[model samples]
Structure formats: C-alpha cells, structure tokens
Target: MWLLFLLVAAVAAVFSCARVCRAAVAAARTGRPARPPAPAPAPDPAGDDGHAPGLTLYEMAYLSGGPQRLADVVLVLMAQKRRLLLAHTGWATVVEPVAQDPVERATLSAIGPDGQRPIPAVREALVADEAVRAVADKLVADGLALPAAARPGIRSGIRQVWAAALLVVLTAAAAYWMAPPGTDTALLLGWFSLPLVLCLGTLAVARFELHPYRDWATDEGEQRLPGKADPPGSRLPSAPLAPLTSLISLALHGPSALTDPALRAALHSSGA
Candidate 1:
C-alpha cells in the first residue's frame, strides 16, 4: 500500500511539472526577440506640445520603465516646472495647485489635502487611480502598450506549481502513515526525493520561462515601436526643441542622460 501511494504521488508530481514545463516552453517559442529592428520614423506634426506624433511621454515611460516609471516622470516634470518640491528623504510637497493633464491631476490628488506625502505612498495611491488607468488605456489604444488579453501564459503555470507542492505534502503524509515502526531512514528519504525534486524543478522552470514576459509591453508592442522601447542613445533628438525632447528621453532612459549636471544632481538628491 505504501509503495502504491508513492508511485501515485510520483506520477501526479511529474504530470504537474510537465504541464508547467510545456507552458514555459510555449511562452519561449512565441517570445519577442531581445532586440527588435528599429521602426521607420513617423512624421511629426509641428507643435510645442509635449507629445510626439505617435507616442506620448506616458507611453514612452510605459515602454521603457512601466507605470512606476511614468509616475516618476510626472513627479520629475512637476519639480522641473516648479509645481512641486521633492525632499531628499522621498517626501513630496505641492507648490502649485494646478495640473497640466489628467495624470498630473491624479498625482496631485494622491498627495492629498495635506499638500505633502511620501513618494512611495503617492505611487501606491495612484496604482488603481482612474487618471492613471485612463493614461494606460490610451497607450493601449495607441499601440504603445500591451493589451491584457495578450499577456504571457504565467497564471496557469503558477497554479500548477502550487498544486504540485500540495501533492508533495500529501505524499509525505501518506508515506509517514504507511511506514512501519522503526523504519529505515534511507527508505523514507528515498520515498520523498522524487516529489521534492519535481516541486523544485517546476518552480525553477516557471521562473525561467516567465522572466522575459514580465515587461509591460508585449512582443507586438516591442516590434511596433522598437526605437521608443529602448533607452535613447544616438537616437536622442537635437532639434531647437531639444530641451523638451530631452525631457521625453530622460523619462524613458532615466536621469543619467540629463546634460545639465545641476538638474541631474537635484533629481538624484530626491532619492527617486
């Protein structure tokens, strides 16, 4: 009876691991390339508007650094425009009551009637915020961010791994119950080994396969806007409006790209 239970448990474990492995392999097979080709530049309509022809600052931030990055850019812009003050300790203070956009308004609301709050707390408050959601929806509609339906097959694989772990626990309990008094240690150890290996193996494979799909943009989004998806290098704009353009680049690429050392120092001092 003990041997039968052990065999059944081993089969169950193998089946669960196999399911996860297959999902992982499938995700890899359909995964996006590490470096997709640059897309042809689209013509820009002449304007001083912060948004480019095909992409907005929010979209660029999403492509490069996700929602949190978008939030960071909003905060940076607010500080640069002298509408907000950021302390080195991560607290933010509203200096201006006005907001330039919905995202800006949402960010201000997150800071609350107190007129000041920690950056992390503000970020948390904005996670489910309607204004943030509106920005994300626009990005998706504009082909800059991935739609929810197109995400990688991670949920099922995760469920399988948990199920396999439960099976391992149940198998161990059965083994203990069926073992005779003063059973040899080696026999018990051998009985548990297969299920343990299967559980660990499933988790490892899930992590490997699901890692690449963790980005905010999907394979389709990456392919469509390859240039915008990466950190700006030689691709940085040099027009008369370079200062405004650079802000977009900084939002996507990060503060290190700022030409103004003083501005960079100020941004870094905020501890963002």
Candidate 2:
C-alpha cells in the first residue's frame, strides 16, 4: 500500500511541478518588453483647474510608484502643508483639521477621525480611500493600469509552486514508509531533491521577472511614464515644491530616483 501511495504521490508531484515550471516561464515571458512600440496615447485636454481632466495626483503616484507611492505623496503633501506631523518612529499626528487638496484630504481621512495613527495604518487607509479608488478606476479605463483580475491570476499561479512542494514532501514521506527496515531514509528523501531544486529555481526566476510588474501600472504605463520630464520649476533645488516633483519622480524611477535625501529618508521611515 505504501509503495502504491509513493508512486501516485511521485506522479502527482511531477505533474504539479511541470505545471508550475510552465507558469514560471510564461510569467517571465510576459515580464519582457514587447517589440514594435505601441503608439503614444493622445493627450487629454486640460481642465479649467489647470490639470488634465481625469488625471489625479493619485493616478500619477500610482503610475510612478504603485500604492505605496500614492501614500508617500499624500503624506509628503500633508507634512509640507503642515496638516500632519510625521516622526521617524512611524507615528503621524494631525496638526491641522483641514486638507489642502483631494490627495491630502484622502490622507487625513486614512488617518481616521482621530488625530493620531501608525504610518502603516494610515497607508492601508489611503488604499481604501475613495480618491484612490477613483484614480485606479480612471487608470483602468485609460488602459494605463491592468484590470484587477490580471493580478490575482498571476499570484495564484505563483502560489501553486508551494503547493507542489508540499506534494514533493508527501512523496518523500510515502517513499520512506515503503522502504524496508533499516533502509536509508535519506536516500528516499533524496529522490525529491531534483523537484525541490526545480521548484525553488522557478520561484526565483518568477520573482526577478515579475518584480517590475507587481505594481498597479500595466505595460502601457511602464513604457510611457518613465521618460516624462519633471514639470518646469518643480525640479528647483531646495524649492518648497521640490517634494511634490520628488514624489512624482520617486514613482517613475523608484525610491533611489529622489534628488532629496531627506525625502527619501522620510519615505523609508514612513514605509512608503
């Protein structure tokens, strides 16, 4: 009975591992840039408010930095406007009852009705805020962000590798049980080493390939946003508006893209 179980488990492990390997490969292929560049999107007409209609600060942040970037921008704006005080310990305290803009208002709302909250909690709150949702919806509509369904499918495929690993363990256990008395259990476990190694290798490759796409933006957003220049006057050295452009730059290029060391430290400290 143990021998039959071992054989069946071995077969199952092989099948599951093969599926996982295929998924890893597919993910890697998707991670690569597509050939024959896509045409640039037509520019949206400017709104009377001086910004493009339907393009919110949240969307810009999402395109550049993902959700954390959005939170970082909000928190920075709040701190700059003196609406909130952020400490190196990850605590945020509200100093002003009013917000300067929609993004700032969303941050204040995420900090909750109370005057104080942990930075992480505030970030989580911002993710669920209406402004964030609106920006995400707009991005999805504009094809700048992937639909919500796309992310879950990729994540589910990645999770299957761990499930396959469990099957490998079961195969080993069954093999050990079927072995004769005094037989080396290590040799039975060794039968699984190849599958284990393959599974781990697939995971590593997937992680490397998928890291850039793990955020909200789709291929379209990734191709277009990074090349955009910082708006005039927004890049000035030691300017009060420096944080605003810095936040946008951080979104486009990553945390290291920030010109201001203090802003980078603040983002790191806030877990943004």
Candidate 3:
C-alpha cells in the first residue's frame, strides 16, 4: 500500500510538472515565432544613417524558484546619439518603451566622427588588429569574458548542497519517528536522490539565457580623465584591457576599424 501510494504521488508530480512547463513555454512564445536569424547590416530605412557612430549593449538578469521567480527580460541599448530601452511582455502586442535619452551636444562632440558603417565591419577590424586581438584574447582567457554559467553554478550549487544536507536530516528524523520497516533504506535513497531531483526540476522550469554579459556600470564608473584617484572597488566587469581598448579604438578611429560578420549579424539582429 505504501509503495502504491509513493508511485501514485510520483506520477501526479510528473504530470503537474509537465503541465506547468508547457504553459510557461506557450506564454513565452505566444506572439510570433522568433524572427529569422538577423543578417549583418539588417535592413535599414532611409534617413536613419546620419547619426554618429553607435555601440549598443544589452543585459538581462533572471532568477529561478519554480515559476514564481520568472520575469520577462528588459533590454536597454545605449549609443552615441540616443538610447532606446524597452521591455516585451508575454504577448506580442505588449512591447513597451521604457525610456529614451537623446545625446547632449557636448557628448556628441566628444564621441566624434559619425558613420553609417555596419557593426560587423567594426568587429572584424578589432579582431584583425593584432595588438587589440591579443589583448581581447588575453582578457577572454583570464575569465573576464568567459561564459556566466561557471561562477553561477558554483554559487547555486553551494545553496543546493546546504539544502540537501538539511533535507537529509529532516528525512532521517521523520523516518526514525514513524516510518515502517525498510523505511530507513527508503529514506537513505531519498536523501541521495532528492537534491538531484530538485536541481533538475529547477533547471527545467527556469528561464535560462546562455552567455549572459555583466553590466558595464562598474567599468564606466571606474574610468577617470587619466589623472584622478582610482575609485575604490571600481573594476571593469570585463577583462580590463580588451573592452577598454576596443571601445577607445572605436571612439577614436570610428567604426571603420573593425569588422566581424558574426558580431555584425548579432548587433543588426538586435537593431543596435
């Protein structure tokens, strides 16, 4: 009877989980299917190219706790002439403008050398600049630009380990107080299997994005006019040398310098 009860509970749990996952995915994709892969130099309307050279970056943050912690992503793109920030709700028609900031004349003067060059062209030039590429490669190697999964896994894994340790204690206590014969072995099995189940379940239902980039806020704040005291704890979120060098090169030489087709395609897709 106990075995039958456990089996029925397991089946019910699996069915419930499946229903929840399906509903979530349906809600996310309710509008149109995702747009086709955006090509480099995305189709541009006439009269949109007279602005200064622009570099736009996006960042998204997410959390996992069953379905309750899921949040729609917000995207913020900042560039030389203007900034466009927006969020997409679950439905197709739910896009909303978060804010837009026009560049000041002084800032524009500082950024200088306007262009219609595509972003891919810039990425290519950066990669080809032996001096720049060497710095970027070193930054990537030193964990500044590596994928986000590695560090988060260590942090979240520690949380799971602590939770599992507590669950084992609770399960043992309950079994000792009231479970029937052979329940000790069952409790041991549960202790060993429970964390695996919880971790996989969290992952299955979580909103996951690969290679999430950190915010540039830290780096921006650290930059001084070459003679100021270094701000405390002000470190670039990325490998300090490469991102700074690249941005400086772009700022100085303009977007004509680098050209990476893949990067171009991605920025174009983003409408950056």
Candidate 4:
C-alpha cells in the first residue's frame, strides 16, 4: 500500500510542477511578438459573446492589462465622462449614478450602494466579477488568450506544489512510524525523495528563470498588437478615434499614459 501511494504521489508531483514551469515559460514567450495565429481552435460557445465586435478598446485592455487593467480603463472612461470621481486619496465616488454597460455596472457594484469605494479596493473587487471573466473568455475564444488550465502569471500553482512536497514528507514520516521494526526506512524515504526532489528542484530553477509576468496573449496576439491603434468595432479615421485612442493609451500604457494630473494621482500614488 505504501509503495503504491509513493509511486502515485511521485507522478502527481512531476506533472503538477511541470505545469507551473510551463506556464512560466509560456508567459516569457508570450511577451515577445506573437507568431502568426495557428488554425482556429474550436470556439468556446460562451466566449466571444458580442462584448463588442472584434478586439474593441475593452478587449485590448484585457490583452494588455488582464483583469485589473479593465478596472483602470473603466475608471478612466467614467472619470472622463464625468460619471465617476476618483480622488488622489484613493477614494471613488459616483457622479452620474448610472452604468453604461455590464463592465461599468460591475465597477459600480464593487463601489457598493453607498456609491463610493477606494480605487484599489474597487479594482481588486472587480477582478473576480463575471464581467471581467467574460473579457478573458472572449480572448480565449478569439485565440488571443491562454485558457485557465494553461493561463500564465499565476503563483497559486507554486504554492500547491509546495503543499504537495509537504504531504510527501509527512506521508513518509507516517510510513516510517508504521513500518515493521526490521524494515529499512532509509530506502523507503529515498523512494519518497524522488517526488520531493522534483518539486523543490523545479521551484529552485523557476526562481532564476521567472519574473512577474502579466501578459496573457498568444504569439499571434502579440504580433498583431504592434503598430495597432484602432479600437475594435470602429472604422473611423484616427481623427475621429481620438477619444478611444487616448483610452487605448491608458489601456496599453497605464495611468501614466494620461497627462491629467488628478487621474495620475488617483491611479498612481495611493494617499489622500
């Protein structure tokens, strides 16, 4: 029984650790120019649900900023339109008290019925909302995003691998305590070490190879983003695209993208 469990655990540890490393590697690669998109994968029925036609400002925001970027973009839109107020002190107040879309509604929801919340708090809260998840889903369906099973920029898997390593250690200790008096426990522990070694070794290698990766697009997505300024669904000339263009800037560059002083303060330094 103990032998069987050890064998299973060893295989489990190897696969789980491999996944984390692969995600890190994929993240590193995705930051570079996207290669030509491969043949379209099967469509996710729930994805690409007309969030706007192909790759709108919101989509680009998700591509560049992930979920948090979505929050920032909405805040930018709302603030620009004078529908919401963001203070340098990190607080948000609704000005219009109305939402224009599901994403905006989600932001308003995060701010609560009291109509105010910290910018960071709202940003964090919105990350887990259905609307944010939908943006990600659309990306995946469009071949721009890696699926959840294969999504990158995650630290949770690392923690899970560590937990698995701990389990192996504890199981080995328990096995040793239950073994017959004459049994050679060292050899048994050595067998268990196979999985532990794999887990720890992968983590150590990752420390050197990995950085904080926020990119979520495939090579094709990366390739198409360069020199791209038109927001999705709008065919207007760059002149007419000015407002959205600034949004694209905010989406791609971040709060610093704007020249506005107060917005820079609210999105940048978190103080009153």
TM-score list, all predictions? 0.58, 0.60, 0.26, 0.57
* Model 4 deviation from the true structure expressed as Cα RMSD, one decimal place: 9.6
Candidate 2, residue 221: the lDDT equals: 59
lDDT tens digits, residues 209-267, model 1?
A: 45434566554545444356455645555767666565676765776766656556655
- Residue 187 local lDDT, model 4: 91
- In candidate 2, what are the lDDT values of residues 184-223, reduced to their tens digit? 6776666666677766676787687654345666666555
Residue-by-residue lDDT tens digits, candidate 3, 1-272? 33443443344444444544453343223212233312223222210121211111111011110001001111111231133212122111112222232212212222224422233333333224343333323323322232223334433443443454455444445444555776656555564354447435644434242212121111221121121132311322235344333333222222222133432233435333
lDDT of each: 0.65, 0.63, 0.29, 0.69
Q: Candidate 3: which stretches are off by over 4 Å? A: 1-16, 27-173, 181-272
Candidate 4 per-residue lDDT, tens place, 1-272, comes to 56866876787788779778777776545444344423433333211222223455666667766787778888878888788998888889999877767888998999999998898889888889999898777667656765565553346667767877887787777777777788778898889998999989877776554422325555545444433344432332256545555566676666666657888788886521
Candidate 1 deviant stretches above 4 angstroms: 1-53, 140-212, 226-232, 238-246, 253-272
Clashes of 2: 1
RMSD of each: 7.1, 7.0, 17.7, 9.6
Error of 2 at 33 (Å): 16
Find the candidate with the highest TM-score and give its number.
2
Report the backbone clash tally of model 1.
0
Which 10 consecutive residues of model 3 have the lowest summed lDDT? Answer: 64-73
